[model samples]
Target chain A: MSETAQRGGAIPPNSATPLVSLRDIRLTFGSHQALRGVDLDVMPGECLALLGDNAAGKSTLSKVISGTYIPDSGTITVQGEEVRFTGPNDARSRNIEMVFQDLALCDHIDVVGNLFLGRELNKGPFLDQKAMLARAQEMLEALEIRIPRLTARVEKLSGGQRQAIAIARAASFQPKVLIMDEPTSALAVAEVEAVLSLINRVKAKGVGVVLITHRLQDVFRVCDRAAIMYEGTKVAERMIADTNLEEIVNLITGGH
Target chain B: MANYTERAKQSHAVEWLNDNAQVLSIALFFIACMGFFWALTDTFMTTGNLLNVVRQGAPVLIVAVAMTFVIMTAGIDLAVGSIVALINALAAILMANGFDWVTTSVMMLAAGAVVGLAQGWFISFQGIAAFIVTLAGMSILRGIALYITEGYSIPIKDQAGFFWLGRGTLAGIPVPAILAVLVAIIGFIIMRNTRYGRQVVAVGSNLEAARRVGMPARWIVCSVYMMSGIACAIAGLLIAARLGSGSSNAAVGFEMQVIAAVVLGGTSLMGGRGSILGTALGALTILIIGNGLILMHVSPFLTQIVTGVIILLAVWMNTRLFGAGFKLGKKG
Candidate 1:
């Protein structure tokens, strides 16, 4: 176990294979080819920022990888074993999770209930409220999100807090590769920082993260490696420390 | 200048009132209605009148509970009234054919499930518009009911125990009322506390997001229709017991009443927003209005038009008054 952990390429100096390896991924919707032979590897414990503008096929690629839409042709390998995800649940079962931009939370329900949503922790016939609440409390605490009322309806929560709950929900499943689609797009600056901090904390656990965002600042701050998507293909890949934002922006717009 | 603070406080209060105008207006209407009835009539608050109110509200409440789930997904079921008619006719015909009570009861209830499955499949899996599928279902089911009974009321004679499913009471409360409360509690648990329940609301609010999160959007959408159908079947059974017969035209205007109650309770017809509690209250409010009109000697035909206007007004108010303060996010 330690051998695999240490030899994981992006995990550490001795870490094992990349957690997610997408090779020659191609997808088209209607007449548009959203992803054109895109190739990338998400190593364990590393934050890979997928940076691009609108129509850069960032959303489409994320969906394909997360099982929202199957790739027209591609090979997705987890830990060196190729797998095909037919749907979101299939991806999730393989420990690949996506926290969508919308959060996908039920507003009428309270915090604890929303956290568990599809993957509920149950006891016999009834929902184990005590058990779920305790686990949720622990998860929130781990994420350092202070939701004063666990029973507070999600509609009543502020934007930042709701985002926190959503992130915490994704983390609850203990996913190996957590994909976030512009998780900070709707947040204020302070809320963005909060999410950034949470992302950093998750990174400490060695969970590989694929962050889909247009924010170059977030890429610089949190990501170790940045992959640029232009039109339907990956135009450039840069290490965060070695490259500046200007070149990446140029790559995104396909000028460089 | 002399009363600047006082003026400021008054303005602040008015601003606060404006912010909560939707809830405040509904409260004010309730108060005004109660006061008008109290002043004009002596027997308005009597137990007998209230019991009459419960009985009248029972059928609408049953249908609205189903509507709650449908509207939560931003979908509508127009076949409810027709479904009630069909179930009623099924029960009556089965009894006439010498079917045992338990078998007949299960068979009658199963009709709703079959209808729900058919319509739900089209709407959820087949990707048809809910309005068109249920509207077609409404026509088809009503025709089936009429054809089953030859457009006449079928008197139930053999299924004495089955009649109790609708008419039998526990302690002193009406069976339908008890059943309504039970259904509400179950609905409340599912909608407010369970994972499957949350998935329904999530899917209703935003299909793409729900799918990305690994929710079984198709199944959730389909189940809600089943729920609506079951509720309608229950209402049909109770109506048959109360009338001691089944007819094609039973609960003729029930869909309007159910939709009115759900809208009044603040469930958005646009999907992804609704509450069973609100739906129940909405049903009760409609019941109260009808009862008040009847007690005040208002004509039934006019009462329906008034009810329709009130529903329209309530929905309009929901948008105009509370739309700003309570704006729902694009996604759940």
Candidate 2:
């Protein structure tokens, strides 16, 4: 294990506290245990890939962090202070935004509209279309994303373009802890590369990102640390520098 | 630069056509209907007849404007006709009971909003489907209207101002028509320019997306119904004022006309995509068809059949033809 893995990334001289710290989080649904005593810490300026098989509780744990599901018993600490989220809005207010696998874009709305979905800029009672348009262009350009027209409805866009817009929407707001579930699932090779680079940029901005994905190659590209989940419990945590593909794959398959 | 376009994409012109297809198709249909009426009837092209068409169609237009908002959010308000009938009867009864026209109008409008709020509550907050809740509202409200009027048309004895709302002309235009036009303009502004309008489209397009983004999704859904309610009050007041009487039968089969107008204007039944401009054109087209058919000495029952056929045809064009890119001369 690397020094960062041994101390759980807590010994860094400049940044000591994790952005989001979870301890003994457990949740159940009927007869199935979705999560069991999972302890994890998301440090600032780091990307953590959460790896698991199909019923490995990756989504459940991400939802718990995003406030979609309230855990039955757990301690959720943001900035070292214990807190419980009542809903996604509560999590959002604390600057913890999640990009779900579905990329919740309103298909009928225009590109600018989806980018500013929840928080729209308005002048008087009307939507500040000019301001929003200008700002939208800037946000997309900053991320090196290009949509032919900002006013075109999102349904008219391609899947990769749609995925890019969804990420830009969540990433542009400067969230402290950004959680993305399978964001690159719909992307092609070049699009995936763009996303990885974008993740690196977001990490540099001191935003702790929780990436839940099936593509393990993407894990090596963007993730600095990884936590593997088996059944409902987190089997092991590995620092990216000290871990390889085989070790993480074994950890996910319950090999110690 | 990272090109996000991984596959073949549409050109800007094709995309624009796809977005505006419904409105354009409806506009063309409106013009075609007008020309057909003009070529057929000598009297239909006259200003007097046109003004009369607008005047009579005003009440339906008012309700249709609100219906656009309701349907834009992928929700339906089936009880609008009942609301109009209830308000129509209630307005006359209140006037007969020594209430002034202004006060009665205010009270009637409030009642309309309350009815809408109640229905909205059941549909949105209570998680009931909008169709079921409003269907029940339609029955219950019409029943209330029948119960109150007791199968009688209550007359308004002496209210010239109230009478003017329905029967009066403003600058050679009917007051009702003027009011309806104003409401349509306001509805256009709201749906196109306002933040609330964007939210309505957002909620209708993908409700889960809207909620996830922290929008007041339930409140927005509920408020559109409230708008429908307030519009019903206006339409009711106009009818009562015009006829100088109110009864349970004031707006019989009125819902059919208003809904047909909305759907004909290219507002999708599935919600999320609608245009107030399209609705206004739709209301006018329906008005022209009825007026033109009557001028041609056709049976009154034929108007209903024609209107039903038009609705079906228009919706078919909307979903089947316009669902794809609206290429003017290009073939697949």
Candidate 3:
């Protein structure tokens, strides 16, 4: 595993100081060691594709980065400063946002409300609907996401639209490190193209993006580096240009 | 030239209809009930009869308004009747001991809030289900009232202003009805325009999502219960003032009545959707049914059966007919 070039990060190795660095992180649930001694780095303006089979700790490791799960033993440093995140809110304050695979959204809440879920715009004691509506328009337009009506409840939208809303919400947070778990898995062909382009747009803005997906072809399209995991440990990290699809597939199945 | 690349816009009228399906259906049901009663009884449509309906329905209406918020968070307060009973008994007890009406009323409201907060703390912070906590509250609070009152009704001799709250009229409208309308209006504005209202709906719709977004999700859940408690206190005071007596058995079956009204008004029992206007109308419909049944010379006990059946039918129609997917507004 150490023989591979840039065996640095299923997180990636870059010249600049990483926006986020995770070292020897471990997490166990009951008897299952979800993540065992994982090291990763998220660099600025780069896209890192986290690759592994079903139980290779991709989600668990991503959760650690997002602060949904606190590791048992490890050090997580942001921009060279070590920190302990208490919860998701802690990670959010440091400009790290995650788009969940299942898309944690309130179906009954409108698109605008979902976009501003926890951070509502209030005028005195009331919801500032007029202000929020205007801001929501700007955010949606900036992302090039087209919803017929901003006031429409999320439940009424199609799957691709809902996914678009989730991505837009996270992207609008001005996050330095954006973690997206299966951003294009449920999307239609056109929607998938939209998401890939959006990833490039976010990367162009100098934001570090970590994408976790089962679609192998996606990494070749938007990822700068690919990190492979085998049984809770990172086995290989490669520049997208340095590795072919066969080698990544072999690495994923552990040379099966 | 149509730009087929861009999504077509929906007319605002359709959107408004989609958002208001529940309220509109409830309004239709309410009007049907009103018309049914008016046809059967000559006195049903009269101004005096209408005033009596609102006046009598005021207590249930006030509690139902708060119950809409509670239900919106997918919570139920089974103890509202017991809280009302306790407050009614306590108000009389306080007044009998030489406390003025204003002081006793203030003390009763505070007690109600304390009781509600305790229950909310258990339900929200301690992770207990709202139904279980409030169910226990129903029994314990009523038991306290019965124990203190010795199963007797306490009488109030004086306090004109307090009695006026229940019986006085301004512009020929019953004071209790006016108070109920004020409560309903305040509830409407809160649910429509306030941040607290939005928080309540979001928490009810999806607690985990609300929490993930960093909203005070648990606190919002707890606060709704407090509002329910305060509403119960207000209802209890009104009852005590109107009857000129406070009894241990006051507001018995009151929780069921309020729940029925909220449900009949298209406030989903499953949570995250509610309407104060629907609730007010729901309360009125039930009150009118009771009054109309008596006027038609039907057996008094049959009114309960009829009201229960009406609630069942109304809620069934609301869900099965105008269900969540039954949007009137069409998007292009």
Instruction: Please name the candidate that would achieve the greatest lDDT relative to the true structure.
Output: 2
Q: TM-score of the B chain in model 3? A: 0.95
* Model 1 spans > 4 angstroms off: A1-16, A28-33, B1-39, B158-170, B312-332
Please write out the lDDT profile of model 2 over residues A1-256, one tens digit for every residue: 6534432333232356889988788899998899877778888999999899999999999999999999999899999789999999989988898988999999989999999998999899888999999999999998888788889889877777888889899989879999999989888887787788888888998899999999999999889889888888777777889989999888888775
* Tens digit per residue, CA lDDT, model 2, B1-332: 34565434568677677678888888998899899989988999999999989989999999999999999989999999999999999999999999999999999999999999999999999999999999999999999999999999999989999999999997899999999999999999999988899999999999999999988999999999999999999999999998899999989888889999999888888889889999999999888988999998889889779877877887788778776455444687
- After superposition, the stretches of candidate 2 with alpha carbons farther than 4 Å from their true spots are A1-15, B6-15, B324-331
lDDT by residue (tens digit), candidate 1, A1-256: 4422221223232356889888788998899888887887888889999888899888888888788889999899988899988888888898888888888777756688778776677776567788988988999888777776676568767788888888889886788988999999898777888889888889889899899997889989899998778888777677898899888888788786
Best of the candidates, DockQ: 2
B101-187 per-residue lDDT for model 3 (tens digits): 999999999998998899899999999999999999999999999999999999987989999988889999999999999999999
**Where's the lowest-lDDT run of ten residues in candidate 3 chain B?**
B1-10
lDDT of 1 by residue, B1-332 (tens): 01001111224455455434445555565566667776777888887777657765687888888889998988899999999999999888887888876777688778788888788999999999999999999999999999988999988875666666566667766777888888888888888666677788888876876766667889889988998998888888889877788899898978888888888877777777677777776777778777787788879889988877877887787777666455322233
What docking class should model 2 receive?
A: medium
Q: TM-score for every candidate vs. truth?
A: 0.84, 0.95, 0.95
- Per-model DockQ: 0.21, 0.62, 0.46
Candidate 1: pairs in clash: A6-A14, A6-A15, A7-A14, A7-A15, A7-A16, A8-A15, A8-A16, B72-B272, B73-B271, B74-B271
Q: How well does chain B match by TM-score in each candidate?
A: 0.87, 0.95, 0.95
For candidate 1, the TM-score of chain A alone relative to the native chain A: 0.93
True-structure lDDT of candidate 2: 0.90
